[model samples]
Target: MRPWLRIKGVFVYLRAFFSFVLGGLAAGCATVGPDYAGPPATPLPAAFTRAGEPPEAPRVAAWWNQLGDPTLASLVERAFAANPSLAAAQARLLHVRDMSRTERANQMPRGGADLFYAHARLPSMSGGAEDGSQLPSRLDLYNVGFDATWEIDLFGGQRRAVEAAGASVQAAEANLADAQVSLAAEVAQLYVDLRGCQRREALNDDAIARQQRGLDLARRRREAGTASDLDLARLQGQLEATRADTGQLAAELDGYRNALAVLLGLPPGTLDDELAKPAPIPLPPTAVAVGDPTALLKNRPDIRAAERTLAARTAQIGQAQAARFPRLTLMGLIGIGGSHLSDLAHLDDFTALAAPRLRWNFLDFGRNAANVDKAEDMRNEAVSHYRAAVLAALRDAEDALARFRQRRVTVATLARAVEAARRAADLTRERERAGTTTMMDLLDAERTRISTEQRLASAETALTGDFVSLQKALGLGWAESPRH
Candidate 1:
């Protein structure tokens, strides 16, 4: 054959080979196993049954800001930036993203350049030494080459692997978001508790002061023969009890401060000076907007992560099924080397090689079949888990809503009780000044007012805490700045 004709024939052969490879890939695009349509839908109510108000769109992202407390907002932001758990979640997300990228790279051709040098000595047979003299007893070899390999995804196994990896990456991201939601809620709750404790402590201080004054008066009256020992003892006992309650409040305040500091990734007592001054509990808006159940499914990170996990598991089924088929790999190498070291300089003396390898474990004692069965089982488990997640999310949101709504009612009732007690105390004080009521009557009325006020403070704190829980259930706080 003519040289030009030979070159043309080679080009034609190369073209045909590539066309076959491409056609195979195009046909193999139909992946094995059942395709993932989407997450299975779970039945949900149109609106939360316990939602007191009309359903409206919830401002779930950055919901902490809606509480109208800048300090709580700042703490949440700080926690997001520094909390150890959130940092760990972000690291997990990064790891999965890198793994996903690696899976994608597996779909492309792989090439490497290699250089090898070696010296070897061969032993001669004593009886055949004269005949062995024709062969060299020692040799030095040097090789430099570029080699390439590409595994054709003829059954879309590699493609399914890549798909699974991508879904895993999304799941990791959702996990990170869930961490953020939890962290923000934790910080806000701790902050509210701290403020509530401070308020209680302040009230306790007033009670202790008033009880001391009353005790002093009772002692003076006893000394003057106007009061009995029983009266003085009762006054002293009340003072002691109030002082004991103050100690408990102090401990609670310290604990809340320490917890808040830790959530911000700071050492215990770090926030003491900053939070030493008492502040009011952050209150929720009058009309909380909680979107429908469908919105909850989309917003909640746990649900999203679960759904992604199901998708990844579904892809794994296809991957396992594909494994039962054959794999095609194309390998090629080009190099130059010779017996003499100087021969390495002769570029024209280089050798070239190419091969296509096909492998199939046609009989592995049903191992591939077992793998496919396991994969299908895993997918089914994932489906169950995803449904469980959806149900759990809905239950959580509804529970939070119930608690918040009831807490609001409790707070309102307590506010009314506090108001009535204050009015009674005012009336008692006036009656005492008019000589119609005794000092004890005024003292008792004042105590009642303070006690009711304390209860109101506690109820207010719980309401705010419930509000935080509701926001967390709605998957708020992950949409803030510096998102991963």
Candidate 2:
């Protein structure tokens, strides 16, 4: 070959090599998975009508703090730290992070080492001079080698896998947050119910005392032949019913206490002493912000988590589709191994030479095609799930706002009914004493007073419950909490 021609050929080869390297870099940039597009913007209200209301302040970390009950706050903190379900969710997030790491490793170079050693024994040579056969001989052999493999990611399949894994990690993180929100809301609701039960028990205790007094008066009248036996028995029944209510409320209180203890990851009955004391449910600050419905999409952990999952499934579809294309893998071995350790450092060993390899799964076309189809189907399912979650969230918010407004009205009405009933009961007693009213009238008045009082108590409980529900609907359990 001419010297000038050789130079030209070498230059041509150098240009091709550089071009190939640049092409590989460009291909690596292309991630095979479905590119993630952010959630579709849903039309939302310009502003929240209830925004101006004196709702409780929103809290981001430990929303139970807004309840303003020290015990409740402490319990919520403990639950966040120790609850098994929450812990499990957190662990799942960590696992997904590791899985992402594993996928990323596929984009990196791989190598391994190998060592080999052998020993051989040779029998004495039979043709040696008379009676002078050679003694058995022993031989030893050693070999060492190194090996490595790397996938070029020509089709971006590995990149897509990594992208999917990363999305899964994000989804898992959102799942943990969702668990926290749910746990906090549940704890708060149970605590509220417990407090309400205590209030009812107290009210019933008062009613029992008043009914006992009425019964005693009835006994005095009957002894004087002024009241009938039927009147005394009716009074007795009223007293018994009042006492039963106290027991019922007490039982309900126990159940709630037990439930709270379990939520805090404690053994049954652990909270009996702490929660046994009756305390009113803490109300959120009036200025708490219930941001617009659009804001809720961001605040609600479940919604965010579901959206992340959808994104991950979309990425998986890309990964699956990439599998249908050619995969270029570069594999090499660089490790050294020997039967004897002494030979490992020898450069002339069997594995000292550089080795490069390539692999491709060019067959099984139908299987790869099916996987791509399945991934696309899953992506579709995920999109539907995300949409459903958004609708459900909006419904919850609307229901809570309306119910909260109605509860306030109901409470006001019940308060008036309670006052009127108390006055009627007083008037009936006064008239009976003056002999202007019969025993039957007094009994009717007593029943009406107790019924009204019960209704009032129930309404009070319901009002607080509605408030809790509204907070939950607003996704305020973790986003907005009351002030200290």
TM-score of each: 0.93, 0.83
**Candidate 1's residue-wise lDDT over 1-484, tens digit each?**
5644544454455446656776767765667877899998788888888888657777666888888988888898899889998899888888888899999999988888888788999875344456644466688998877777888888889989999999998899889889989998899888988889898999999988888888888888889998899888887888888899977898998999999899899999999999999887788889888888988988899999999999999999999999999988887676777777887776656666667899999999999999999999999999999999988888898899999999998999999999999999999989989989777788899889999999999999999999899989888778632333
Q: Residue 383 deviation, candidate 2, in Å?
A: 0.9
Candidate with best TM-score: 1
Sequence-dependent TM-score of model 2: 0.83
Provide the overall lDDT of each model, using Cα atoms, as 2-decimal numbers: 0.86, 0.74
Runs in model 2 with CA error above 4 Å?
1-29, 47-58, 120-139, 335-341, 345-350, 422-450, 479-484
Kindly list the per-residue Cα lDDT of model 2 for residues 341-444, writing each as its tens digit: 77666444333233234455668859988998899999989888888888888888777777777777787898899899989989998998998987678767
